[model samples]
Target: MSESSPDEPPNSAAVLESMTLLATLSTAAEVGKSVARRRLGRDPSAQEPPDRAAIHLRNTGRTLMDLLMQLALSRVPLDHPEEPLPHAVRHFDLLLKLRRAERLTQDMHQRLLSLYPEVSSELVEEARLLRNKIARFWETAPSDPDSPHLSDVLEQGISFVVWTRHEVPVE
Candidate 1:
């Protein structure tokens, strides 16, 4: 990937590759958005368009792509980690960008409480404890931290996300 001057255009392979990927993303987004339309379930004989869920799915796809791209491209605690992390040799969904991931843990905990009042206080506390564990996931330089594998919890979180991706009454 060659760097371009301010007056010139970038001719790097990365740029071309990104452009191609964006085109593909557009196609994929349309497919996902199309399926969400309300008219899809309608009888064709009755005559109607699709029943579109809403336009927000565009942001959904873009956000997912951004996370996927970040996960694929780099290792962490990186992309500018907070000061004082002694060891940062880890990269997976659970611990990637360890600092940011820890932050997201708290944000998600709050999001869950705001969205679902019925969510148990115990569960919220569990998330808080998990956040604390994550905060120290890479504290030790040459050995594992005190926390158990947080990826186990992340796996369940990812599973539930996938489950929600389906329509109601999943078979």
Candidate 2:
């Protein structure tokens, strides 16, 4: 792939959104792996449980937000669909808010690959299935796009993840 020069203009909004989402998904994957390690009960060097837990949880939230952004951007197939920028930004913001307290499950890995094979080199079907599940959840419990409740979930999830990380005793 050719790299654009610094003076070059931005690509279409959809492209930009896709790139952003990709970056976020990568981060989420790393955090998810950390969470998986915690799930297996590996203890880290943080003296306090809460502090250690908080660190893991924050990483998980950051990771999920990225994946969510990727999903939202992929929803628009058109090269430069009208309003792609706003929709992409809105979804990106929402994922950042839904931030989970726990790390992503192994299912996340399967799903991500299934959905974005170009990025994951793994089965895309897994990600596609997970994506569908999320779409269904939203369809069933639709909320105001601008509600703070979503962010609250992220905050709570972060705490939960951190606590779980602590539960794993040092080996």
Candidate 3:
């Protein structure tokens, strides 16, 4: 058997770990969404009562999305004068942007639902359909051969330092 290069990932293990993490993240998001829906008493067939609770829920969702975006952006390496980002890196960037768009669509749907207009129902339905499509795209696109592994993207995102306590020495 030929020895694999150091840069070559252990495909099975990486994929399994990534899938597990994805499941966990998906479950957490679903739980959060469920709680929000319950608190807001959201019914797709019926318009939800506009209240502070619904506004708070929407704000919480937006905050979560903002945090996720910050985390993802932190992973991006500083641009070099001579070298371009790797294919996987670019794919990761695209993935993050798609996620933001998905979140925006979700928020739009929530807002449309609150409007409770007869004509707005059609817009809400369209937004719901778009959100579902976006979710599916986000779930499956990263696993493509040409795309970066989920674990790699997540690890990179989580590996950056936001602050340091150590003092820098003068040159």
Candidate 4:
């Protein structure tokens, strides 16, 4: 076993925790995308203007997925012993933001369903499926040592959040 400096963390545990957080974030992004797709499908009629909330949600989800994909496919390394804890903290912070976004999206979905009662059942069912998938993903722990570091993952997530905010111009 390699000994870490006093200021550095135990590498294995920190790496595992960071990977797990990234997995959860990836799953959350997938759920958001699924929900957004369902919402977008609600209004098939071209006569009505597109739903801004749905559009924003879709854009946000897509942005998240893009970031996750970029991070996963990149060659960035997480081998630094001193970087894990800060990365973990940033990941945690981003996770909170993603959760907040999900909640807001859910609220928008509820409001949309209320406005159009006929579309309620299908959209709700779709959302339910997505939530179940996310839960399953969350239950799975990440054991891959080759996974990217927390800083890289957090950077991607933050970029998505910033980009989406600009693209959608929504709260």
Candidate 5:
């Protein structure tokens, strides 16, 4: 359809936001796959069984990839000031969880540290504490299915990762 045609849907700012979201999700998928293949040892015939560390790392990466895709699909431009913030916060939580798992891997953590110098030693310690808190929350999942505090914790934890000044590629 012609861009100027009245019958054509207007490609407003929201449409650009959707495109950007799609691109970010595509990049996340590529990064997640690379991390899994390298860290998890995709070769089925590998001599050693994947350790708990490997399993957790792979699971976290996979979860982040899924969450990123969900965020892409769920996003919309902030057209109305009164509207709730985008659910990208959930994706941020997943990213933070994956980052925690990455921290357990010395190489991965160091790579991230080099790339994001803002993650100081103190911040790393804080992340460890937050990880424990999230773990504790999970332990009481059944009892806290609708816990308001859980949502608040997740939102605050995710806000840090999501608001970082990194440029994620779009495909």
Candidate 6:
């Protein structure tokens, strides 16, 4: 009974809208997968001979959103973001630096927290546990504590979080 626009076909409007929605969703999935592979480092194992990307990207539709929400967790394969800072990836090397610091300033803690904030409690805890292990290892203290460690993974995950979560001075 109501008047419809002359250019619009009212009878087939629902069908047309459905088609549009389907196309939009399809495009969105395509774009999402492309970004996952390119930027997020799609699971290399999916490829023949296992390329060295970080994420395991199959059937990740549900968990992908959760993982993506994490600010510090990254797709890189490093143990820490600041790896090779002192030429090696040993806890002792870092432990030495920490011990050498005349004072463990709040700034140092804040700097680390900035990379992986308190919001990311699990990683912070993991890093702390690793530190404890390093100290324990230091007591017995091998000639070199250089070995495979999760410091790089922990470091890489300890990246700066979302902008709003951090302060940005207006420059």
lDDT by residue for model 3 (11-70), tens = 555555665686578668867987897788775445555553246334534554455566
- Collision count for each candidate, in order: 6, 13, 0, 0, 0, 8
Indicate which candidate wins on TM-score.
3
lDDT score for residue 5 of model 6: 92
Q: List the residue pairs that clash in candidate 3.
A: none
lDDT of 1 by residue, 109-135 (tens): 544344333344655565566567656
lDDT at 40 for candidate 4?
75
Among these predicted structures, which one has the highest lDDT?
3
Model 2: how far is 32 from its true place, Å?
A: 15
The 0-to-1 C-alpha lDDT of every candidate, in the order given, reads 0.43, 0.45, 0.51, 0.48, 0.44, 0.36
Pairs that clash in candidate 1: 37-51, 37-52, 38-51, 38-52, 39-50, 39-51
Could you tell me every candidate's TM-score relative to the true structure? 0.35, 0.31, 0.38, 0.33, 0.31, 0.22
Q: Name the runs in model 1 displaced over 4 angstroms.
A: 1-96, 150-153, 156-171
Ranking by lDDT: 3, 4, 2, 5, 1, 6
TM-score for predicted model 4 compared with the true structure = 0.33
Model 5, span 15-126: residue lDDT tens:
5477568658756976787688768665322322224323443444345435434444444445554523332443444444434433332222322343334335644354
- Stretches off by above 4 angstroms in model 6 are 1-95, 101-118, 143-171
Residues forming the 10-long window of minimal summed lDDT in candidate 1:
48-57
lDDT of candidate 2 over 1-171, digit per residue (tens): 678899774466657678588768867886787799688876332233433434443454356655544544545554545756555655555444333312253333332333232332323333343334444344443464543343343343344334434432333
Candidate 3: segments with Cα more than 4 A from true spot: 1-15, 28-41, 57-61, 64-68, 71-75, 78-104, 116-171
